[model samples]
Target: MNRLKPFYEITVKLAELLDQDINAKNRETIISQVNLLIEKRGDLLPEVPPPFTEDEKRVGSDIVLLNNKIQQKMNALFIDLKREMKQFKKQKKSNKTYTNPYEKIQTMDGMFLDNKK
Candidate 1:
């Protein structure tokens, strides 16, 4: 377990680094820190991080669930946008339209006459 301590702490730090959105400067800092840790650990890298227990193995990371949630949100947003566009198009068509019902027109005696009359 002593050997695993360094990796555990490193994993925690990595998680922290990834959790907060950072700009280039902060990203470079975290990456450099990781590289330094790796150099310090040297050949002991594989031994440093022990495998998770059975429980952890069973539960697994929540990353997949989080990813699915994000995907669902994106899909819903796309569907809503498409629905809105469809409604907007329908409104546009309804708003500007010609409902012309030319009942009848007769050209008789060189004059136009309304046949409906």
Candidate 2:
């Protein structure tokens, strides 16, 4: 097995996994697999220096493309996650306010007011 083969395979698998629809159930598995792939890729990183064969060059280019795709997808996912988090926070705040409308009202409970005429 060529050293680059495993690296390329990892990139391909990562791209495929990242392309899946993110939902309650798939989110956990997708995250775990992404982490696993990243670990494997880190360990199996290939160094092709100087003269490269045709196949090696092809695989290298493919890996580069796949990496770009993965990065874009990951970024999009993060943006979506951030948006979802904001919505969730908003919903919680709304719920809390609905439950207790005056929970956040400013009250001068311990303040002394003096009127000097």
Candidate 3:
């Protein structure tokens, strides 16, 4: 229906944004845009709309595929971030050891104290 055109267009734009190599600032912008569109779409959904046309279905499918790709990229990015964090922790620990290698060692010469009654 004509009413759904704006929703479709926004969905397509969201999918295109997901395809971009967006930085954090741009990502936040995209998130806000998507949130606004969701709110608008929700407002329009009070009435039961007709079934999607073929083109709309295709666009919906494209959105699904794009979402999946975005999820995959997020997973990969998380993995890389975790790996880097682990490496950074190891480096920090090694630096600490290098700076103070004997901090944890305990050395006590043999000595005995006897109490007299």
Candidate 4:
């Protein structure tokens, strides 16, 4: 149960950051309520994270690595957007944009592949 705490907190943080609208009180609000609920009721957490098989380990590790990379890119994206926003001050359709969301997804994907060696 204790171990699940970190996982839930991490998920909450991810949700909070994804909200584009400043007035949006969706995931961020819900996750905070959940976190507070957890704090109030300690018994709801699972006793343990389910055991992982080798394949599961590999897949889970892959997900975790990707998540880390995602967080990294999101942070970078925010910084980049901040600079762009400061210059433009309006959302304009760019001629060049990330048509594919998975543009840099490979860089992180390959990390786990190489790490498994």
Candidate 5:
């Protein structure tokens, strides 16, 4: 049995999970699973030793490709998360302003008006 087999399978599974469309409902579960897979991947890394066979080398190369795909997916997800956060902040500010339009207004800023009698 190839030592890298488990690692390769994990990477492939990670890639698949990252490829799924994330919405509000399953977002938390998917993220948790992704984190678990990442930890597992880390734990499995040190177990595999050197002196690679041809099949093992092939699996190793496949794992590299999968890693690249996974990195790209993660980057895309990060960008999307940033965009959503910005939108949420904007929405919150808008809601606040809608609720109290005078909240941000400055009144009587140390200016006095004089009138001639």
Candidate 6:
């Protein structure tokens, strides 16, 4: 009971962090914090604990929902990245074509004679 308070607090913090629109550096910080909390929780898991209270159960569900939101955000970012990459490739190809418009033309071999000989 007393020991679980810290764990619940950390879990709530993690959920709040995930819900925010944080930058990469802040996100890394949050990840490190979560990792530390996970390690600490892992060591404590062997001890038999009482059932979760209503509030604790609600916080757990909130964490799950936050994690899902984070996953969706990442998926959207990946999709946007792929779309931008495709646009970049198309632009590059168009630039190459513009710069080398005659690249497809085949050159004919011609003999050069020494007219001054």
lDDT to native, each model: 0.52, 0.86, 0.66, 0.51, 0.89, 0.65
TM-score of 1: 0.35
On a 0 to 100 scale, what is the lDDT of residue 34 in model 2?
Answer: 97
Candidates 5 and 6, the one with greater lDDT: 5
- lDDT tens readout by residue for model 6, 1-75: 454556555555655555566554565666676577667656766552658787767666765666576567556
lDDT of 3: 0.66
RMSD of each: 14.0, 3.5, 7.2, 20.0, 3.8, 9.1
Query: Alpha carbon lDDT of residue 37, candidate 2?
Result: 96
Predicted candidate 4 versus true structure: per-residue lDDT over 31-117, tens digit per residue = 465456445434433443577566556555654664675466456656765786666643332312345555445465355554564
lDDT of 2 by residue, 5-103 (tens): 878888999999999888766777788889999999988764544477788888889999999999999898888888988999999999999999997
Q: Pick the candidate with the highest lDDT.
A: 5
lDDT of 1 by residue, 32-79 (tens): 765665465455466634476654433334433443553554455457
lDDT of 3 by residue, 1-117 (tens): 464566656555655655677564576676676567667656755542658788767766766776676567556656755787799999999999999999887656666555687
lDDT of 6 at 70: 52
Show how many residue pairs clash in every candidate, following the order shown. 0, 0, 0, 0, 0, 0
Model 5's TM-score against the true structure? 0.86
Give each model a TM-score.
0.35, 0.82, 0.54, 0.32, 0.86, 0.48
lDDT for 110 in candidate 5 is: 86
The number of the candidate with the highest TM-score is 5
Error of 5 at 19 (Å): 2.0
- Model 6 segments beyond 4 Å from truth? 1-54, 105-117
Q: Tell me the spans in candidate 4 whose CA falls farther than 4 Å from its real position.
A: 1-49, 89-117
lDDT of 5 by residue, 1-117 (tens): 368888988999999999999876787798899999999999999999888888898888888998999999888877877898999999999999999999987768888766677
Better of 4 and 6 by TM-score: 6
> Which residue pairs does candidate 6 place in steric collision?
none
Model 4 gets an lDDT of: 0.51
Comparing 1 with 2 on TM-score, the higher-scoring candidate is 2
Q: Rank the candidates by lDDT, best first.
A: 5, 2, 3, 6, 1, 4
